[model samples]
Every structure is written in structure tokens, then in C-alpha cells.
Target: MQFGIFSVSDITRDPVSGVTPTEAERIDAIVRIARKADEVGMDVFAIGEHHNPPFFSSSPTTLLANIAAQTERLILTTATTLITTNDPVRIAEEYAMLQHLSQGRMDLMIGRGNTAPVYPWFGQDIRQGLPLALENYNLLHRLWREDVVDWEGQFRTPLQGFTSVPRPLDDVPPFVWHGSIRTPEIAEQAAFYGNGFFANHIFWPTSHSLRLIDFYRQRFEHYGHGTKKQAVVGLGGQAYIAKRSQDAYKEFRPYFDEAPVYGHGPSLEDFSTMTPLSVGSPQEVIDKTLTFHDSFGDYQRQLFLMDHAGLPLKTVLEQLDLLGEEVIPVLRKELDARRDPESAPAPTHRGLTEAKYGDRPVRRPRPNANRGDNVTGASPYQDSDAEATYPSLT
Candidate 1:
């Protein structure tokens, strides 16, 4: 299982210090956090997308691309890309650019975000959220695979012979994981495409993720991708750790009581027991995380929520140190012991490329000479990069 951290990019005030990080500080901190995750031998680093106050990650692709340049080996991805609001054409173009820039050290997770007013802010209706997500991803999937796209959808204007620039590196689009908290349609969509399903298992009961993952696995098999056990699955979790369990709670409690997401909803103890939030010693965090495999069976990725709820950058960095030095090493051993490599291997760019094209030359698309409107004429792909007739890769 791949292990790492995710950020919501929230700008919350630290309850203990009574000091909220400036937006600049929070942004810089996330960049530092991404590099630290790489330094610590973690596998993935993801940031969320939000367009409202208290959340600052409106442009996840841009931020992830920046993170991509600063680190190697870490799989840079979005905690949840807003599939409902962003133009699918832009997503296809921008992420493909990132894939090339990162040399395939990237993938993305898609979800209909929780924020409601964001729908109309982007000229979409909240009522049509599910349909928007479904249709948009369908188009995105096609955009990555097909060179010439002529599309007309309910939410977006028509496209005529459009090509999303910078065709995916190796002509293999980044692997997608559909994320959902409550909606099963998203799970169904992921399975239909033979993609991965991710449960944002933070701030919720494990049973919630269990049902969603189980349904996805069954549907994935029904669609003939693989057996139920072979379905691709990713899970989200949150934790705060220290040398002692008591210290962990004392440090996290103040932020827990006043932060926006789950504040005042349930007592911390009750919430921890009911959900995947683990505030404890390193051992406790490891022990709690292990139970997830027993509950959901073998899965592919595991991401932790480490930097949120008013935690200071220094403190969050310390948590990563504990996670890297003390927690993940043990988890890796335990999870590897239980999982067979062939049945549940890690997802990597090399692995996916080989799966798609084994011991064969990969295609490198060269765009045709410029054509106005892309409506009447354009050659979208060429085999060689040295040709003067081909436009530069976007």
C-alpha cells in the first residue's frame, strides 16, 4: 500500500497560539510539506480543491505541478479534483502537461466536492452535480485516449475536432481514482471505467467506506476489469501522533474543538472511536490503521490527512517525522506481509506503462501545423518530435 499525506489547504487559526497562518505561509508550508514527504520515503502527496473562504486550493493542478518539480518519487495528486465545476477540456490539458513535466510522477482523484455554492459560481447547478461529474469524466477519459475529440455535452459548449494538448506521457493518461463520501454513483462510475475508487474515510465511520468499497469491487468485477479482490481501491485516513497517547490528544484537542469541519459535532473520544481519526502514540496510530485492511480487505493506496484544523506548520512537520521514522516503516512491513504482490501491487508509472505496452515502443504525439478553430482541419499526432511540421508539445 502507498502511504502519504493530504492537505485541505484550510487557513484556520491555531487555537493554542491564537495565530492563523497567513495565506502565503500556508501555501509555502504545503510546498515544504510535499518535499518533506518525499524526503521521508512516503509515496504520495495530495492537495484538495476549494473555492471558498477557509480553503485556498482553488487550483490543484498548478500547485501539484509546482510540487512535482520540487520532489521525485512522491506521487503528486489531488485529494479531490472538482470534476463537476472545472472544464473537462482544461483538466485534460493541464494534467497532461503536468504528467509530462513530472515524467509520470502523478495521478488524480475526482469527486463532486462538498461545497454547494461553488456550482453556480462556475455556471453550473448544484442539483445536476452527479450528472455533471459523470458526464465530465466520460469526456475527460475520451480526451486522454482519442486524438481528435468532437464533443457536445449538456453542461459545456460543443467542441469540433479539439485535441487536448500535450498528449499524456507515453500516451498513457494518469490513473484516476473516483472519490466519494456518500454517493454510490461515483463508485459505479469508477468501476465502469475500470478505474480506482477512493473513500475519503476521514471524519466518517469505517462502515461507510466499507460499503462503498465493497460495492465498487463487485461492480468492477461485473464490468470484467478483474476479480472482486483485484479491484483497485484507495482509502483516506487522518492521524496525529506523538511519543505518548496522552500528549497526542492534548495537542490535537484544542484544534479539534474549534475547527470548522467537525467542531462541536461530537466529543473527540467518541469521534475517534467512530471514525478513522487517530490522535495517539505512534503505535496507536499504526494499530488503528491496520484495522482498515481487516475491514475493507486488500487495497491499493492509503493517504493520511496531516495538515489541517489549525495545526501549525512546525507541528505538522513534526508529525510527518514521526510518521516517516516510526509509523510507516512498520505499516509497510505488516501490510506487505499480508498482501501478495501479484494480487495487490503498488501502482507506479512504470507498472502502468508496462501493463499498457509491454516491451514495445511508446507513441510520442506530434501535433499538426496550426489550424484555425480546430473545426475543419488539423493533424493531431505525429511519430517524431524532430519534424518541423509538428507543433511543439503543449
Candidate 2:
């Protein structure tokens, strides 16, 4: 299984110090945190996207591209690409460029996002979130696979003979994972397209997550992607670990109490018991994470939330060290011990490209130059069936 960490980019004050980091400081620290994850042998590092204050990750491509330049092997991704608000056309162009720039080390997760006001801010209605998500992703899927797209949808303006530039690296689009916290239709959507489904289990009970994952797996098999057990799945978790369980709990209680998301609600101990949040030693974290397999089957990826709730840079980095050095080694062995031979591997760009074009040369579509240095040109469309895979204007 692939293991990594995701940061929501929340800029909250340290409850212990009452000192909040400046925007510049927080952004730089995130870069450091990502570098630390890479240094510690983690497989992926995903950054969240939010347009409002207290969360400063509006431009994920710019940030992830920068992170990509600094790291070599770590996969750079977004926690959510905001499918409802951001234009699908922009999403296609930006992430396709990211795919090439990262040289096959980039992938992304798409979601409708949690912030409701963000919809209106982007000139959309919050009530139309589900439809917007469905329509937008359908368009994005077509944009990546097809060269020129002529489409009309309810959420965005129509596109006639539009093509997202810099056709994906090796002519294989970056793999996408549909992220959903409580939406089964999103799970169905992922299964329909044979994409991975990620359940954010950090905030919900195990039973709730089990139902969602089971639904995805069932739908995946129904859609003829693979067997239920072979469907690509990913889960999210949160942890704050140290050498001892008591010590970890003592250190994290203050942050948990003051956390904006769930602070001042349930006791940390209670929350840990109820959700995937484990505030304990490395062994405890390993044990808790292992239980996911029992409930969700042989999942492909496991991502933890380690650097939130105003934790200092030093502490978060140390958590990564413990996770990479102490916890992951044991978890990997134990989880792989009784592996299913037919299980699918976690999605990656190199694997996807190879699956598409093994010994043969991968096609690269070079679009005609834009007449006005933009999408418009004498013919920006590559007019190549090899990449388009079907006729345009369908």
C-alpha cells in the first residue's frame, strides 16, 4: 500500500502559545513539511485547496509544481481540486501541465469541497453542488482523453472545439481519485469511470466508512471495472504519536481542545475511539490503521493527517519522522503479509502510462500555435486520433 500525509493548510493560532503564523510563514513551513515527508521516505504529499481565510491553498498547481521541483520521487497531489467551483477547463489545463512538469509524479483528487460560500464566490449555486460535480468531472474526463471537446453543461459555459493544452505527459492523463466524505453518488461516479474512490474516514465512525467503502466496491464490480475486492480504494486517517500513548495524548489534548473543526466538543479520548484519530504511540497508530483492512478490504492507499490544529513545524516534522521511521515499516509488512494476489496497486502516473503504452513509443500531441497566444488558433486541436481516441464534436 502507498502511505503519505495530507495538510489542509489551516493557519490557526497555536493554542499553547497564542502565536499564529503569518501567511508567508505558513506557506514556507508547508514546503518544509513536504520536503520532510519526502526525506522520510513517504510515498505521497497532498495539499488541500481553500479560497477563504484561515486556509491558504487557493492555487494548488502553483504550490504543487513548486513542491515537485524540490522533491524527486514523492507524488504531489491535491486533497481536493474543487470540481464544483473551479472551471473544469481550467482544471484540465492546470493539472495536465502539472503532470508533465512533475514528469509522471503528479496525480490529483477531485471533490466538491466543504465550504459552501465558496460556491457563490465562484459564481455558482451551492444547491447545485452534486450536479455540478457530476457534470464537471464528466467534462474533465473527456478533456483529458480527447483532443478537441465540444460540450454544453448546466454548470459552465459551452465549449466548441476546445482543447486543454500540454496534453498529458506521455499522452496518459494523470490518474484521478474521487474524494467524498458522505456522498454515495460520488462513489458511483468514481466507479462509473473506473477511478479510485477515497473515503475521508478521519471524522466518521468505522461503521459509516464501511458502508461507504462497501458501496463503492459493490458499484465498482457492477460497473465491470474489477472484482469488489480489486476495486481501487483509499482511506484517510489522523494521528499524533510519540514514544508513549499517554505522552502523545497529553501533548495533543490542548490542540484537540482548541481545534476549530472539532475542538471543545468531545474529549480527545472519546474522539479517538469514535473516529480514525489516534493519539497514541507508534504501535498504537499501527494497530489502529491495521483495522481498516478488516473493514475495507485490501485498500491501495492510506493517508494520514499529521500537521493540523496549529501544531508547530518542529513537532509536525518529528511526527513525520516517527511515522516514516517507526510506524510505516511495521504497518507495511503486516498489511502485505496476507495480501490478495488479485489486489490492484495504488494508481500512479508511471503505472498508468505503462499500462497504456508498454514497449511502443507514447504519442505526444503538439497543438497548432494559438493565433492570439491563447486557446484560439488556426487549429489548436492536434487533429490526431491516436490521442483523441475518438472523433471530436461527438
Candidate 3:
């Protein structure tokens, strides 16, 4: 049960203050927010990807790398890395580099992002989003595990003896979580790969998320990774907290009413009842969050969206203080007590490295000399298995 915050990186006018932050201000604010999360002992900090306006996180890896340099223990990750639009080769290369740079203190979530027009901007078809997500991740999976890959697919050019440089830290790839709001195929994909499944549990009802999570758990066992209980699961939520429940409601109501994501629709009370959004005192937040475990069963990671809907930086920081000081300690104790002993633990880089290497020395890949870094040479790594061979174009 890891607790942390994720920002969608929206640069919008504060509904109450009527002041829209400049892009520069929003970017600076995000760094400060992540630092506050770390200071408060949160376990993970994640950011969302959006290529359009009202959102500023067009380059997640760059931002995360900066945060990783400053923070010691906080796990940095993405809420959604566009698997449909971004090339799998680039995804493999960039994230592997991030893994090494972060010292294995990171993981990532991939999804067919919600924005549709972004497809053409990236030279992809929105109608084929599902297939693109499926095919692209298939390649990314191999790119991480295999040192040299020979592959072809519908969405990209063929690869002959391609090796993404800067191989994963300790020879272990970052753990992946497939993020989806309603796609069963995505859930199925995650289960098939024995990867983590993350439900963006904010907009929809808990029952909706439960159905998808239940389906994922079922298929995860079908693939023989482990028991259904052992499936890695993560969820998204949002909260706005104050010392008193009335103060919370009073402060957050205006922002909620005008929020672009779910605004101009349901009332605050109605939306909160129908969705995972929490607005109240620390104890009230804890009470609502516990219901999530009660409905979805024991899970691994829980991330909250706190910086969106035009919340001011100072207010967001205060929210983090309350959450860290009042909400998390109690939730950690309660969830741990209620957890099934047989269920899986939260994903971490150190845990994955140890699982791969145990008592043995971890492999650090050192590329062999070649003609200007060509992959046509023999096994790239000096320590590669002797029998492994990569085909040459010559």
C-alpha cells in the first residue's frame, strides 16, 4: 500500500482567484509539489502526459529525471505514457535511460491516452489506437528483456539486430503498469504479461473500476503468474482536505464546479458519491479510501490527483502537509492490518533487482567496441553469453 500524489499538469485559472498561472509558473510549481510530497514521506510521485493546452506535461521523462535528481526515496513515474502515439523504440530507449539515471527508483504506466486529436499530430490513427497500444507494447516488452531484437510490426519499420542503448539498471527493466479507464483489452494485456494493472479510478464509479480489476485479477491467474490475489494492482484517486470537513467542502467546491475534467456537470456531493474524489477532513478521507480496499480487495499502489482543477500551489502544498501528517500514517497501519498475508507487495526497483539477482552479482552491461556503435557487431555487451549472436547486414 504505497501512497503518493500525481499531477496532470494543468495550467488553468484558479476558479476562486480567477488567476491563470503561466506555463513557467505551473512547471516550477510541479517541481515544488513533488519535493513537498517527498518531504512528507510519500512513497511515489507520478505525472500525467498531455500534448494539448490546459496541460503542460508534454515531456514527462525530462521532468521526472529532474525530480529524481532532487528526491532521495520517492519513486518517479508517469500516469500515462502514450503507447499508441510514441514509437516503441523511443519508449524503450528513453525509459531505460531514465531507469539508470534514477538509480532504479522509478517505474512507468502506459496507456492509449484520452486525447484523440493527438494521434494525427504523432502520425497515428485514432481508430487504430487499441491495436497500436497492443502492438507497440509487444515490441517494448521485448526491447527491455532481449539484448538484441529482430522484429517487424504494422505500426513501425522492421528492426534487424536493434539494441536499445543504456540497458536497464541491474539488467532488470522497470515494472510496467497498464493504465486504462474502460478498456478490457488493456486489462487483458497487462494480465497476459504479468504486469501491473492500474485503473484511473477518478471519473468512473468504484463498481466500474472493480469490474475491470476483477477481470484483470482473473486473467492474471489464468496466465500462471501467480494466484489472483498476487496480481499487481494500482489505483488513482483525488482529494481536497482541510482541518474540518466543512472547510474542505467550502474551499474545494468552487474548483470542483469549474474543473474541466468533470465540471459543468454533477454537483460536488453527487460527483463525490459517484466517483473516487474525496473532499473532507483527514479522517473522512481515510474512511472513503478504506472503502476502495473493501471493494477492490488488497492492492499495491494508490496515487491521488491533487494539483489539477486549478488548485493554487500554496493550497496544494498545504493539502500535502495534511495528507502526509494526518491521513497516510493511519491508512498505512489500517491497510497493512487488513491486508491478506498472501497478497503481493508494492512494486519497487530494489525489490525487482533483488528478485532478478538474489545473492548473485548484478549484471552491468558494458558495450563492446564497434564501428561507430553499430548493432551488426557481435553481442554488444562484453559479458553477454557466448552463444548469443546478432546478425550482420554485411
Clashing pairs in 3: none
In angstroms, how far off is 377's CA in candidate 3?
A: 2.7
Please provide TM-scores, in order, for all candidate models, with all chains considered together: 0.95, 0.95, 0.97
Residue pairs with colliding backbones in model 1 are 366-382
Model 2 TM-score is 0.95
Overall lDDT per candidate, in order of appearance: 0.88, 0.89, 0.92
lDDT of 1 by residue, 146-252 (tens): 87788998989998767788889999989999999778899999999999899988878888888988899999999998888888889899998989999999989
The regions of model 2 sitting more than 4 angstroms off are 369-383, 386-394
Clashing residue pairs, backbone N/CA/C < 3 A, model 2: none
**What digit string (tens of lDDT, one per residue) describes model 3 on residues 1-394?**
8999988888988999899999999999999999999999999999988999988999999999999999988999999899999999998999998898899889999989867899999999999999999999999999999888899999899998788877888889899999987899999999999999999889899889999999999999999999999999999999999989999999999999999878889999999899999999999999999999999999999999998889999999999999999999999999999999999989898888888889999998887777564544447788877554555679
Candidate 2, residues 1-394: lDDT per residue as tens digits?
8999999999999999989999999999999999999999999999999999999899999999999999978999989889999999999999999988889898989998867888999999889999999999999999998777889987788988777877888879888999987899999999999899998888899898788888988999999988988899989999999999999999999999999899999999899999999889999999999998888889988999988889999999999999999999998899899679899988888788788989988887666554554655235556564432323555
Q: Which ten-residue region of model 1 has the weakest summed lDDT?
A: 383-392
lDDT of 1: 0.88
Candidate 2 Cα deviation (angstroms), residue 11: 0.3
